[model samples]
Structures are given as C-alpha cells and as structure tokens.
Target: MQRVKPGDGRALKRFRWWQSLSRALFHLRLMDGDSGQTVYSVDVRHQQHSSSSGRVVAHLYLDGRHHAESTVPAVFPVQGGTVEVRASTVGLKRCHYVTAEGAEFQLVPDPASAEGRRARLDRSHPALSRCMGFLSGTVLVVGVVLLALQLAEQITRDPEGVAQYAGTLTSPIDLSGWANTVVGLCTVAASTERALRLRYNWLLDGAAG
Candidate 1:
C-alpha cells in the first residue's frame, strides 16, 4: 500500500453523476472499541487514460480524506482490520473489510453509483434479484458451451495428424454470423450485471471478460 505523503495534501474528489458508470465508491464503518466509529472509503476510477500501464488504482480515504492509494488488488491497513480492494475488466470484483480475526464484511456502495443501484435492487426485491442472478449465470454458461463447441469444430476441421489418436469431432451447433453476434452481446450484458454485484468466477466471468 502507498501512503499519502505528509506534504501531499491532495483531497478526494467528489463523485460525479456522469462518472457513475466508470467509477466505484464503497464505504466501511467500524467501531474502534471505546474510541467510537471510524469510516473508510475505497474509490476506483475505471477509465484512467493517463495510466500508461492501464492499471486501475484504488484510493483509500479515511473519514472522507485522502489517506493512501495503490494499484489493485490492494490492502490498506485500518484501525481494526484491512480494506481489500480489487477490480475487473468491467468493474470492481471485490471490496471488503477483513478483521484481524478473519471476519469479512463487504463495504457499502455509494448510493449514486451503478453498483449501489444493483445492490438496492437486491435488498428491495430479493426474489427478483435472485432470478436475475440465475439468468446471468445461465447465459454465461451457454456462451462458454457454444465457444467450446466452436473451438472443437475448428480444431477437428483439419485433423489429419490427430485422426489416428482420436476420431474427428464436430460442433453440434453452428450459429450464423448475426446469431453469434447476438450471443456475444448477451454474454457481455450478463457479465456486466454480475460485475455490478461484485460477483466473478474465473471460468464464467473470466470468459466474458
């Protein structure tokens, strides 16, 4: 973790309405025993054009002031625990406060952001949220299956050398150009929805990414 230099008095910028789609802000409040409560915030800007290396950095804020900044996945020490932050191609994959005793708690998302809206939906309509989550997973699974079949068909198209080892294989489903494009769009949408909830699986979401 990179600490904010003492003399570097840069302040945390306010979250703008237009940046909701490309930015994430999360907050965690912890009780410091007899010392009372402490608040920590994690901020990430997904579209940082100035970052030549294309790495997303997470900024740590203490009680609304700039405290530290680090390239994710980052871990910033706090009063009682550490704030862990991670980002993905679409958005943040993880943002949690982990106590020294190993207890983990997800930080609260800023109400104005996309992630916050999705989380609000989950809380207000749990059944509907669950249905949406199921649909997203199903879509991703279908996409991966179709991709695997297409890859297999391509590999076995010219199986002259490998014919002796294994029989030629063919894809059961052959989608047209427009149909494949539709599927691709659906997969992207599904992945984006999952990202809003900070849900990611190396196999399912990774393929979409």
Candidate 2:
C-alpha cells in the first residue's frame, strides 16, 4: 500500500446522496489503552465511469481527516491492527480490521449507504434476511447450471471431428429467448443483492458478475 505523506492535510469528501450508488463508507473503532478510543473510516468511490482499469481506490481517514489512500486491495496500518479493504466488480467484497493476533472485525457501514441499509434489515428481520440470502444463492446456482447446459449444447451442436473422442451431448432443458433474458436479469439482481452484504464467492458471484 502506498502511504500518503504525513501532514498532507487533505479533507475527506462528504458523502452525497447521489453518490450512494457509486460510493461506500465504513467505520472502525478501537481502544488505545490510556488514550481512550480511536476512530477510523474508509471511503471508496467506484471507478466504473471514471477509469478503464476497473480498479477503485480506498481512502483511509483517521478520526475524520484523510490519512492515506491506496488502490484496493489496500491495507493501512492502524493502532494495534491493520485495516484491509477490497472491492468487487459490483461493490465491496471485504473491509475489516485485522489484529496482530489474527482476530478480524468488519467495519461498520455508513447508515446512508446501501450496505448499511442491508445490514439494518438483517438485524431487524433475521428470518427474512436469511430467506433473501437463500434466494440469491438459489438464483445464482440455477443461472450457472443453465449456463453450463447451454454451453454444452452449443459445443455439441457442431462437434465435427471431436465427436469421435467425446460423444455429443445435448442440454436437457431448452429455454426460450425471453426465458433466458429473465434468467440473466435475475442473476444480475442476485449478484447485486449479495454485493450489498459484502458477500461474494469466486465461482457463483464471480460468474454472475
């Protein structure tokens, strides 16, 4: 991680209502023994419209002032621990403080952000939250299975000489154009829902994204 020079004195930008779709903020607090408590915040702006590289930067703030900034996955040294930040295509995938002894704590999302709203829902309605999570996973699973079947059918449709080595295989389920479009839409929604909770899987969510 690149460290911003000390005394740089850059101010952290205030979160705007419109930027909620493309920005994220999270906070962490730690006790500093005799010094009492210390506060740290992380701010990330999505680079979807700004950069071709698709990489976003995470800014670390001490108390409420800008301390350092680095392109994620970023690790910033803090009191008694390090703040780790990572981002996915749709949203954040990780933001936690790792202690010297290996303990990890997720930073609290800003109440105005989408992630914070999701976390609030999880706290207020655990059962509904669980059901939603299950639904997201099921949708992704169905999407992946359908994708695999479609690919198999396409490959086997024109096997050519390869049919001799591996017999042609056909997909059992055939989806109409509209049905496929629906599935694609659902997959995107599921991935977005998972992203709001900072939940990501390399195979399932990765493929969906």
Please report, in order, the local distance difference test score of every candidate based on alpha carbons.
Answer: 0.84, 0.84
* Candidate 1 lDDT trough over 10 residues, lowest sum: 1-10
TM-score of each: 0.90, 0.88
Using TM-score as the measure, which candidate wins? 1
Q: Summarize candidate 1's per-residue lDDT along 35-150 as a digit string, tens digits.
A: 68878888899876226446787788877788887777888888877888878888888999899999998999998888888999999999999999999999999999999888
- lDDT over C-alpha atoms for residue 79 of model 2: 90
State residue 99's C-alpha deviation in candidate 1, in Å. 1.0
Please list the residue runs of candidate 1 whose C-alpha ends up more than 4 Å from where it truly belongs after superposition.
Answer: 2-7, 33-35, 49-52, 161-164
RMSD of each: 2.3, 2.4
Error of 1 at 177 (Å): 1.9
